[model samples]
Target: MEGMDKEPWFFKDLSRLDAIRMLLAPGNTKGSFLIRESESNKGSYTLSVRDLDNNAGDTVKHYKIRNMDKGGFYITARIAFNSLSELVKHYSREADGLCTTLIKPCQTRIPQKPWWQDEWEIPRESLKLERRLGGGAVWRGIYNNHTKVAIKNLKVGTMSTSAFLAEANLMKNLQHPRLVRLYAVVTQEPIYIVTEFMANGSLVDFLKTNERRQHDHKHPHRHGISGKAQTLWLREWRLLKRGITSTGTCGRPTSWCLRTSSARSPTSASLASSRTTSTRREKVLNSPIKWTAPEAINYGTFSIKSDVWSFGILLTETVTYGRIPYPGMTNPEVIQNLERGYRMPRPDDCPEELYSIMNLCWQEAPEKRPTFEYLRSVLEDFFTAQKQQYQTQPC
Candidate 1:
């Protein structure tokens, strides 16, 4: 029963043919792929996929649907070619378009090199293991003459080598104060993703620890959030929120981080910052079921809109002092409820404006959810209003 329950309902209930059609649907198509159907002389239907706009040249493939079994269509069987790649090449035709120009890579990204004479390699003896940080483990290490940095050692088997490189490449492009600083990627043996250490630990843990300390205080109000802390929290929140959209780091909740005392100019937190579309997709297949978006769970579709949903949950967790988003609900229960338009209630004392953002994020249709850019503007206004309200108070 346990084994059966873990099985993906997608394979059991949905057929391969139907899934293919769904993938080509208007909502799913991102101009990279297109499917066309026509009638064949032999009474079978012919379907062809036009795969273009990738780094590779244009290609198309045609196949006829003739055989059907309990598992649905045996699509590749009817094609002249043995492999999918071969089939694409058979029917491929030449084309020239504006999109082709747009799809080209701009320039080779140059990552910052280590100042030390010895490349980016970190001596194993220098690393002092601290503790686990989700999928990766962190360690304190020194390089370039006693410069302290955090070393994130991720298991190579966790993902494909290409994915590891993609992540490293993404981090190199993402330069922000609120986001962690990527020093260099050490690819020897187990992958070491080097970054600046946050001595204060993750914001999630920081908040949880603060909540516990406050509860144990002699004077509750005295230990209540100071103005400085409140301001810093809002500022950091804005930075992290903007950084997510700017750098396209919408993978997991842990992707967002903050330094304990470091503060950057508010001008750097503009959500309107333009970003090129990321070619790489943050693989969330193994992520916790709770944090997984509804669309991703049902159809294996993920996008920036889905990230907004996760962000809403993260916001809820932040305001509630690290409380789980759907507390007391199982994964199946959460999915069922979400499909029926169920949304989590606002955390206790959560600001009305922030809760409104949460409601927007939980909209049934992904299109209805506000973009991170939109959220950025709304948050700026929210913070402005908050500061004004505090000023007007009879303090």
Candidate 2:
């Protein structure tokens, strides 16, 4: 067989001046070049090109050019651009021209609402302590005539009020079905945050209830399990597992529980005071220390990846129907076991694919752990295929 003619190769590694020089070179107009501002770095741009005789289609070469005097260069990939000017225009809305290091402010900015105010407050008399959630206590209250919310009260002297406020600022921006909704913050001394109440309690308890219902021989309710409810269960699992990274805060709830209506949101209120040890707080709260990720336990460093590691532990707990992670193991024992590459055994009857995901999340190196978005995509596809297979089966 005759070999296919090789396509023209653009310079994959080029300085800002060199790339511009290439574009200005003779006969370079045959193909399109895409240029966009690099997302991770301001004043840096990514240039992607598709030659006239393209073999890879949208799979074009990418080069990062730092235009500033102190800027550097790199190579990356994405989609090809139609024209250099077009790419410049796209990025120009929020940045300077391709050759400059400055970025322009976006024309529109999201207005930050004042979360703490006396008018939006929950009266002390109306607040009733309900249950322990994270590092705080949730109190049931009527914020207004038709608004019933759970108030999360922070312990005095645990965290600075500024830290709490900063957390509230972040929390107020977050809105997702998998996350509990924040109504308002009572900024008064002994700060309290109001959020939507979930009646079904924690996710572990909810899953346990679901597991019992599945095994109930005397009262079969499989037919009563509406598609919506099943989807909701999957959603709850998705949110609890994947929603942390999306929030830009690696804040995972002390428990991966979901209420009937909402998943508990993580805030500074849920974070143990900087002065205290999480293990001590865990003991005080009577929450399991085994769920703490190895990195967190060993180095006291927490990140989004650390939270994902905790999710792996939570996955084991959920699949096992409230069974403890690292059962019969002390915190120190669990830490030692994990450092030596020991992971929890697969839950009985758990899907191999699901277990594989849990393993990915448990990678020893934080960077090696799979992202929440990737895991969610995998699970979504797997469940979709299962649903399709069932639908195609003969009645």
Candidate 3:
């Protein structure tokens, strides 16, 4: 047994055809071998054998001997010309002939159930109508083409044409990053107010989507890890603060910073004074309540102070990820509560620091509400402190 284990295994008599047959057999037999002519044999054949198996098994014996000594018997099978080309042809034909006719068109034409069609269509129609009649489509500034543009055929008389003219003038004079830039006013049919397009759409749209996604099962709430929910609140606070602190720059912070610095400069101070006087004159000429003050809420007047109050409400909205200030409460109810000096409490998981800031903004007296500049400073401090604490804590 020891000697057998040490013995080298070899095929005894294997013809090339027999070797090929054994190789193609279903049961594995390791392999078979063939004898062939070598150059050294001149015309004699050489015993070029190989092992069939190293393991102990019932193996098939096969052989072929070719003479080189006199070249009497030469065996060469045309194995190279096998039917490999036939397989390629077979598949090519099958693929080309295969038909994939649908029994039905997958009901694709059944009209896709719009994810938000039910809730949004009516509101969207209302918005379009409001935009049409409220002089929203009226252009107010020059366009690149230098043509005075305005949307025409707007349900005219619904909104005073004088008011539209005033808005157009206001828009023309306005050059701030936060405020939409007015190029030209065109009063063609349907009124086309050409302004810079906001790729990010509106704050209202973002708020709606955020609210929907929060409750979507596909996107469950995940906490911590920079706390994205809290981060959104912080962002809202910053935006509100920016909008409040700067004047004549719309609602963008960067634009406000640029314009504010220039306006405060000595040379710009004279220009600023003139602009201020002009603005006061315009206010007297056109007492629009669209941008009214907080006091106006009671008396139907809009002011910067009232705008700040609105900002506070907006901040609350952001913190809650678009949750209504008073869920299940009607607008009348909300207004009544406001009249009674009522404010919504912060969401349960809201940071305490944020809650405090919101409370300050909701002060009964509009004048008592912290200015945007003050709010920004407070938020900066709070954020810095929180970051420091996070860094100091052990993992």
Candidate 4:
């Protein structure tokens, strides 16, 4: 009580006083004393002391004040003393209120509804052909809901509705650490495919942003080679590759390679002649033929093998930070090169092991391409090795 500015007191029933005495008895033995309120005071008091404990055997001494009104009472408490004086601290009235509230156990329980039951119903009119936003054959829009999900609506007539169903089915059946999760498929009206939102956007968006930042800063070509960038690119590529190749199906037929050697070659004269005759020359020339596998381009057929070839192009794009595989070449030229069995050149900075993997992925024969499982294992090993190297190096 030597530290008290004034005496402390509180009005309470006999039972409450007994409980407080029992709680503070241990502190009393350890040289604690209380300063009681002056007898003239009413419904107001401060409890200050040399030492006080809320509970027995606790080293911390609490200082507190209480005020009683007709309806309720307000109380505040703080640890006021410690052997290490430097460790003593104070708390605000709101903090003491929080401590008092937390002293009691919560009894409320609320059952959560299943996701399917709680999500919004898809509108049928939204799926109508005329309701499509973009003029192009494909409609792409973000479902601006709480989750901000993306939806791609391919023109029903351009590609059969089966294609959309196939994608949805594939998404549902697939399970990979890197693959985006398909939460639900609603076929009630316009088909709605629900998926988890990726807050950071796609790998494509990230690479584009990175490239823009690098150019804006006028940084050197090697500027983005930091460990963080490398790790991010590696992880993105691994996830993308896994998502595409997880299906056991092999793409385009092997026979496409046999015919590729003999496809009509486009000469400059032929290209020039076509340009003069056709208004669609540019569109014809800039088409995605080259990136398409020989079978897909020539026969209008595609399979998992063709998907692998596309994945290789995507991998190149990712590694080069959004650089097209063959810049300046027209679509026709790309197709011609593919027909001639010319693969895209690996980036100068690409690791040899990665280049080897790309070569396998870009194999002319679908059967010869490595499986996704095999690719995952190889990448895992590479990542593990890289991590070990990083750990061993001095910071």
TM-score of each: 0.52, 0.52, 0.40, 0.45
- What would the per-residue lDDT of candidate 3 be over residues 318-359, giving only the tens digit for each residue? 445455556777654555566686777767666777678767
Q: What lDDT does model 1 reach?
A: 0.46
TM-score of 2: 0.52
State the lDDT of candidate 1 residue by residue for 207-248, as single tens digits.
Answer: 466544464242222211221232343443433322121112
Model 2 Cα displacement at 387 (Å)? 2.1
Question: What is residue 70's positional error in candidate 4, in angstroms?
Answer: 57
lDDT of 4 by residue, 75-159 (tens): 3323323211111122212234332211111111122244332222344343322133223322233442333343544445544
- What clash pairs does model 2 have? 34-81, 203-257, 203-258
lDDT at residue 35 of model 3 (Cα atoms): 31
- Order the candidate numbers by lDDT, best to worst: 2, 1, 4, 3
Q: Alpha-carbon error at 350 in model 2, in Å?
A: 0.5
lDDT of each: 0.46, 0.48, 0.36, 0.40
Q: Which candidate number would show the highest lDDT if scored against the true structure?
A: 2
Candidate no. 4 TM-score: 0.45
Report the error of model 1 at residue 224, Å: 16
Specify the poorest-scoring 10-residue window by lDDT in model 1: 260-269
